[model samples]
Target: MSNHEVRMSEWVDRVLPSPTAALESTVAKLQREGQTVHRLGLGQPDFPTPDRAKQAAIQAIEDNFTGYTDTGGILSLRQAVCDSLRKEMNLSYEPDQIVVSAGGKQALFNAICTLCREGDEVLIPIPYWVSFPEQVKFAGGKPIFVPTLPEQGYKTTPETLAPYVNESTRILILNHPNNPSGAVYSTRELLELAAFCQRNNLWVISDEVYSTFVFTPEKFTSIAAFPGMKERTVVINAVSKSYSMTGWRIGYAAAPQAVAQAMLRLQSHTTSNPSSIAQKAALAAIVGPQNEMEPIHNEYLARRDYFVEAVRGLQGLECLVPDGAFYVWVDASYWCGRKLLGRMIHSSDDLAAALLQEAGVAVMPGTGFGSPTHLRLSFAVSRSELESGIAAMEAILGLK
Candidate 1:
């Protein structure tokens, strides 16, 4: 190859950079340059890691426990995960059925790679987490997009997913408390979808990373809790979101023994084990008291209420009150084909750019989440930051 020419894996070419990360980088650059940019783009929780977890990591370091661990994580950590799952979600699993990885992203990659065969189709709901389709493609699976309606709470039901199923369909990737839309599935909804998966013989890779952020009256329920699902479902979760430990990079998956073993093998050749210190931290977080959890959840709910109201009051922006997670998915289609700041607004990408550059606000464009007509605003920051961001946006777009 010539000096100017580069060669990379085909998989690299198939996947796109994560839009959320890109926006974060841009915001960081602007901040470094002394610009006042209000951040509403990232889904990272603003809370600090729990003190118990922090002390655990410090103790682990003091005790020189920062060595390589079992490929599937320390047995104790795995057992803690099993106990936590049993207590929190009414799910039963053996420690051997769990494969702990570097983070939720890695755990998801492991699941997709292990369960998907070449050319098999994976059902992905639109407005999904940015990584879903790309990971499926990297695993040599086709991503079949299934659209869900906002009126239906932006959730996929059996009816919405039925038309996409065919002979080659192998898996359904379910994200509830969905990332961009914050749509949490009800038990009845999950039951119907579970039955549909049973009928179609499809496996499920349930991304429950945001499971603890539900704002609904009913508690969070995993599809794996349904009948006949544990055998075919891979439940992925992490300490990153719930425990405010994103930087620690600890995540895991619970699946059937065969699937867990396959994923463990895949992880063995990749990241052998997650950070030993982080594992210790996660252990403490999992087994320690959770008195602070209720307050954190309530705070997020309050922020969601305020942000959703503020967003809906903006011109050319409409949104539903999300049931879970900390994002408001705003339909900005009304701004498309209109002009803003003397520039023609064609899609959410343009709107997002204009907002960032002209209004000093950072928001994620929906193009990466499979919608060009939407924008995702996160309320996971401080209330002051959220208010500032909303005010900056209102200054530019005007209030309804």
Candidate 2:
């Protein structure tokens, strides 16, 4: 009750710190102290932003295009979004249906806040992006975690999601080419899920930030592209992952007209339009020639292969070859209840801490992704870093 004391909002207690960002900060602090830390925990790509985008941004700066823009984003950039979606996903959208925000996170927050009401239940698949459940809780909705099997490629089917549905269920957040797990749903799976959602009268928030990284024979298909799904779907994508413009911070959402406007209204009160220069850069990236894409994708595919093999070679660790995205979801349950380095390995947090302290390697523990006995490793780093990380880990755990 003291005047100098300020009470924290109940919202502050609902969410945990972002595990990935926390790990990044720890690694950064170590690096600053001149330590050799192998970074396998972060989700950012190592590639540089494309030249066309960079040049466009520089030009915008030179032209003094630095003022605040329309809250929903400039018409040109929104139009570019529509064009990109139409060409890439075969989904038609108008500029008015798109809302550009600071990043995919903000766009997702806007959608979750605008659609999710108090007491609504949102179905979130396990091994989800770390922010999904937290965002739902912040929006006054309860997050219903739907666990998916590793054998099933860490994907949710109607069978897996059915038991969690009820009248309070309002939305299903689908992250394809999913973060951490790298599971990409096929067209058939999308159709089945689409039917399931329609039958349940559920809205879907499709997060497609990694849509460009599919390595499987089947191309990526958004649930929004399925019959009767677009009307109730909010599709989110960002140049951050696709074009390696993470620092530029431009992401967008495509929804029905009403939903899009609602998101825009929310965005207006928050971080209005993203940086104007970044909007220009994103427009250039979207409308420019995409010749550099295939090579970057192929590189990620090669890294995925090498990293998966290296991980499986380590004793007490197993992982499935990912179909898309740049992460390997590793099962480290073998180490739980065991001893490593004369310490108890009770969960992935323990394993991760041991690896970081004793082995100089940093990998994401899976507790934040809803499984404490697993780990998430990123292949998004350089091939040399991946090899060094594997070697560092092998030094601690030994080869299988």
Candidate 3:
């Protein structure tokens, strides 16, 4: 073998560096050198994990439950997941149909690897989570982005996706309570899309990680609830957002028997199983009392109200009142071609850089999510921090 230079996988070459990480690293580097940075670039919650879940992990360690668990995950955790699905989502699943993964990210990855093949197309709506398109490419499938504009709430309608569907369209990834845009699909909206998928014989990969964070009066409905969707929907959920267990890395996927088995086989060759202690902690989160979640939900609701109101009042920017998730997707197209700090800004990337460098505030650029004229501002931090960050941005944008 020649040692000079080696050819890499085509998929690896096509995948770009995560925009979230790139922006965060740049801000972190600046802050490390004694610069103060207000981070709104990443979607991490600032709250602490509930004491009950943390104690469960400590107990698991004390009991020496650190051995290898079932590749599908611990039986108790899987059963808890089933119960959660039944109670919350009104969907029934057996333990055999669920597979615990390192995070919701991995659960989606496993599903893609198990289902998609070379030359297959996965329909993704923009603005979408940064990882979805890259994961699809890594799985050797084509990511066909369905562009959703700010006027349409940054959500793809069933009609919009119809043009992209064909025999090669293997999957359609739906992130209700979306990442960049916190647009939650209503029941009527989901029914229309479900019908389209059913007609086209496409699989539905539902990323419901933000299911619990809905703020509007519109009730949360799972696409799997639709008739015939159960057979094709792979529901990906996690303890990360709802339980404040992001660092714990506990997530799971529920699907039909065949898809579950395929994901299990692929996981066995890859990650094998999720962390045992984290799974035990997640079991506690699911089976333990419900009172802990209420408080967190209430707090997030308050933050959402405050941040939305603030963004709505900002001049020259269009802010969508998100129905779910802890993000505000702001249309900053007004800033394009404008002078900031004596430099002309042309894109979302430039706007984000200017905010971080000149305003000492960090935000994710919309180009990463397939919308080049928008920006995502996370309000998961404390109210005081959010206030300061907004003030700084206002000063930079000349918005009072």
Q: lDDT by residue for model 1 over 1-400, one digit each (tens)?
A: 7724887788788888888889989999999999999999998899999999999999999999989999999999999999999998999999999999988999999999999999999999998999999999999999999999998989998889999999999999999999999999999999999999999999999999999988889999999999899999999999999999999999999999999999999998988999999999999999988767989888888888888888989999999999988889999999999999899999999999999999999999999999999999999999999999999999999989
What is candidate 3's lDDT per residue for 60-145, written digit by digit as tens? 99999999999989999999999999998999999999999999989999998888998899999988899999999998899999
- Candidate 1: residue 397 Cα off by (Å): 0.2
| CA shift of 61, model 3, Å | 0.8
**CA RMSD of all predictions:** 1.1, 1.5, 2.0
Give each model a TM-score.
0.98, 0.98, 0.96
Tens digit of lDDT per residue, candidate 2, span 36-114?
Answer: 9999998899999999999999999999999999999999999999998999999999999999999999999999999
lDDT of each: 0.94, 0.94, 0.89
Q: In candidate 3, residue 123 scores what lDDT?
A: 97
How far off is model 2, as Cα RMSD? 1.5
Give per-residue lDDT, candidate 1, residue 23: 91
Ranking by TM-score: 1, 2, 3
